[model samples]
Target: MMPCYSGYTKSGDKFFICGKLGPHCADARCMDVGTILCDYPVGDGKTCDMPICESHAFEAAPNVHYCPGHALMWRKFVDAGGVERDLKNVVPFAAKERT
Candidate 1:
């Protein structure tokens, strides 16, 4: 007996997205379809882009959401009682918010 695949690309390399093949939520325990991306800025005007379901996403600002990992970090910063001006240094693109 042999296994079958529809395409030449390896399964791991395939890019699954929302819809039929549905991208999975990044959370290991969750099986929900990922419909949104984490908005955490990475660099060069790019974002984290981690696929996440709504339930697992943290809304940082209007329509901006972060994955669980970044979200936790954000929460910790807030809980630490950092001043508002310090946010510009903590977040990758927060300096733009000040402009």
Candidate 2:
């Protein structure tokens, strides 16, 4: 079984966390394939907005949202005026686009 982090959403939703799969890594490339749930619902109260995992979570700076891969890249993006909050709403950019 894949490793995961369990937690509650702001609205009190439970979920199992996994890496955000897509092309936003160190090399502007991503290797995660198939369907991996970056933010998966568990108890189904509302929906957890945080996507966190021990093996995949990376803190770009302090208090910044956890990134799946390429933490530095993400930090740079945020520093360059990117929206930090958006990371939680739309990770694995491709996945968000699909849905």
Candidate 3:
């Protein structure tokens, strides 16, 4: 009538639970194995936003992430005189984009 645990380790009198047991991508739609951190922080400010596989990881700005499709879209946006807004407060594109 006792439950069994696989990742639990007992050292002396203390027990520790192993973190992640397997590899998983941060993007819910992705099926590829994760290999890199997106480098963008989530709202919690403690963990990276996306754990992407090599194929999905787009190097937009050195260490930043934008995905392959998004990278191209971002380039077009910048080319049209659009600037990246602050993460804390996002404004309308019409107001932020330069003519």
Candidate 4:
């Protein structure tokens, strides 16, 4: 299963939004402030929404990032010579139209 994060501040006031100092990294081991969200598409037109720090994020493409686990999966897919169209089918937003 994919890792995810969702919670509020200690005061139970501020909600966690990855990238800000308020939220922590989704990776349990790291304590660094999250810098971005995993771009991996989940379902129902929603993304993984996994909070990831700079060190834990892997750029699959420009402005497209994946969490450590997803990154490894992506790497394996690429290594196996996966098709780009297949990836687009999974994450349409990550691909842009060409002129």
Candidate 5:
């Protein structure tokens, strides 16, 4: 990820879409119509990513518009091996492309 990020750094902070979806992460990077905005990857550990710590999404209107991107920043944070440890290991972030 840092490799892609380094290239981006030279280009300035333009928006670049990144996702761990499909094979490596089996992540569904995009949403479809009728996806129910509040839906947060509901399924088994293989198919879905939501942890048991969360409650089901709301059924009513208004707040249900949030997608997982807008939800908690758990996946990447966890993948980075937790924030405190990441800093202690103390290396610059890497671009996955470079690796």
Candidate 6:
């Protein structure tokens, strides 16, 4: 599993994404195995945190994340040979693609 998650939200079944300070997701459906994806409506605002929650909310700047501790643990999991089920390299593949 990824140390963190990335996606939007759903109100009826997709409300919105709430970063580390995450919102209530016990209601959303499981879009991904071992993970949850949701969506929500964006509100009108004018501040630094505004873009963080765009109207489209399509900003894929890492939808969600694990706490620092979990992030570290996840790193160890991969380094110690944890299975990577994602198509993209858990370690990143852009480098190889660029070559």
Point to the candidate with the largest lDDT.
Answer: 4
Give the candidate number with the greatest TM-score: 1
lDDT of 4: 0.75
- TM-score for candidate 6, residues paired by index: 0.23
lDDT of 2 by residue, 1-99 (tens): 543334445586765556544322221233223222233222655322333433355644454344444455666777876775666588464544565
Better of 1 and 4 by TM-score: 1
TM-score-better candidate, 3 vs 4: 4
- The residue pairs in collision within model 4 are none
Considering summed lDDT, which 10 consecutive residues are worst modelled in model 5? 2-11
Q: Predict model 2's lDDT versus the native.
A: 0.44
TM-score of 2: 0.22
Alpha-carbon TM-score of each model against the true structure: 0.63, 0.22, 0.38, 0.61, 0.17, 0.23
Error of 3 at 19 (Å): 14
Q: Sorted by TM-score, highest first, which candidate order results?
A: 1, 4, 3, 6, 2, 5
Local accuracy of candidate 5 as per-residue lDDT tens digits, 1-99: 621111123345433433532222112432211223344445563223332111222322354332345345445665667867767888788778765
Model 1, which residues run further than 4 Å from truth?
Answer: 1-21, 87-99
After superposing candidate 4, which stretches have Cα over 4 Å from the reference?
A: 1-20, 84-99
Clashes of each: 0, 0, 0, 0, 8, 14
Give Cα-based local distance difference scores for all models. 0.74, 0.44, 0.54, 0.75, 0.36, 0.36
TM-score of 4: 0.61
lDDT of 1 by residue, 2-96 (tens): 22212113343433223354577788776666668999989999999999877788999999999999999888888887646586678464445
Please give the TM-score that candidate 5 achieves against the real structure: 0.17
